[model samples]
Target: MSSPWFGSQRSQSMTEFALVAPILLLMLFGIIDFGRLLYIYGTLVEAANEGARVSIKASSPLPSNSDVENAAKNGAQSLYLANPCPNGPLPPTSGAGAQNPPGDQGWIFITEPNPPTTVETSPTYDAPGGQSPASATGSCSAINPFQSGTYPLQVTVRYNYLFFTPLLEQLAPSIILQAYATDYTEY
Candidate 1:
């Protein structure tokens, strides 16, 4: 009789573990996914900075430089994603990294002073990086053509994250991470 009771207790423990394990695993994946998203976001920001620096490399090139853009894209490829940006992917128009797919491109946002217009950019990222990637024009101080001569350039890169758990999916159908870095260019 004691043997049967002990066996029943052990079975109950296993049942409890089975019930709790999935939730715990899900939580663990959620934590990992979130951490990865943050890391990717930072990487994108760095990539943008690299790209923005490209414009200032030679004090501006004619009609923008595609090689400069590729340098930015290559910098981002270091953190290459298995499931690149699904929200939007912009292809390299020209330069070294032109062979890369649209999903692996870095986007540029140029706002010239006084009614800024987009100088060069991808199809999906025609807008500037605002307060947040999604914000409009970043609530930025109005551009002054008389005072500031430099063109404000922002590089925005996107990354698509594949989630292992459903928790993250509930937040969004597909996790598209974005990073932006802004710089001033005389050109």
Candidate 2:
């Protein structure tokens, strides 16, 4: 009896552990990766919301494209406890003066005047070949669109999130998040 108990049982248990160890490790890694992904998503949402809130401020004239970029960077840093923008800075604001147009930029939006419409033509810029000529440009209106209570403030944020875990990186190299909000400014 003693010989029977010792001969095969110990080896069987060892074999079971050997068979299960890798699976267990992979499961643990999966859980960790999922949690990290969730955290990143939450952080991105908060950052976008923060950016939108900052954009609706009429009193301060809303942040410039650079300012919005900084706001996003700060928001992400605060939420993630790490800097998300390592390539010098987050994308410049989307409005004029930005290195890249807002639509093309990675993050940030400003309430600059929409491009002007020509009296000679219907609002056609939305269609192909509708872009105004370079000489057709005019200074942005001094009038705040929100003054008449018709145009509400708009906030938009774009974020590029990088995974902190190697496992997640291998699965989904990176993630992009976008958020938008609309609210009237008191000013």
Candidate 3:
């Protein structure tokens, strides 16, 4: 004769597994999504740092806006695979220049915190927290050099991060991650 417990054990185990499976899967996917978010954010920060480093070097000819931008792009090639989303966040303040890059790839903004002694020729990309200079257009551009004083060179990188998990999408349909690197310009 089959024991009562033995006869029902298989069904009970299956029921328990069925009840716990969704939660476990959800947790597992949640972890994966979180990891991806961290990785992308870290990459963005590293890219900004790299661009700032390139900008700070005392080269015979200062690195052009493109050069610094290239360094940043190279630093985070993995981001290209990510599905591009619309630009995230407006410039710091309403008046501040729009920080979002024109292209889906992203953009690098090189700005001097302290106004340069000479008038900037490249068309100011950002106002003192206002819309990008009317003269400046495109994703990246080199700001004019400062005559004196150790002013900080700020490199800001913006990228829209797309979440893989549906739940994350519900919570955050569009997420833009920004990273900044500041280094004193080499005189």
Top lDDT prediction, candidate number: 3
lDDT of the candidates, in the order given: 0.48, 0.44, 0.58
TM-score of every candidate: 0.57, 0.53, 0.70
Instruction: Please give the TM-score that candidate 2 achieves against the real structure.
Output: 0.53
Per-residue lDDT over 1-187 for candidate 3, one digit per residue giving the tens place of the 0 to 100 score: 6686576677889999999999998888889988987888899899878977877776656565566667778888766522121011124411345333332345556665432322333633221121123332233232344533455766677776666778867887656677878887664
Point out where model 3 deviates above 4 Å: 1-7, 81-105, 114-134, 137-143, 147-149
lDDT of 2 at 73: 58
Worst 10 residues of 3 by lDDT: 81-90
Model 2 lDDT on a 0 to 1 scale: 0.44
Is candidate 2 or 3 superior in TM-score? 3
Ranked candidates, highest TM-score first: 3, 1, 2
Model 3: what TM-score?
0.70
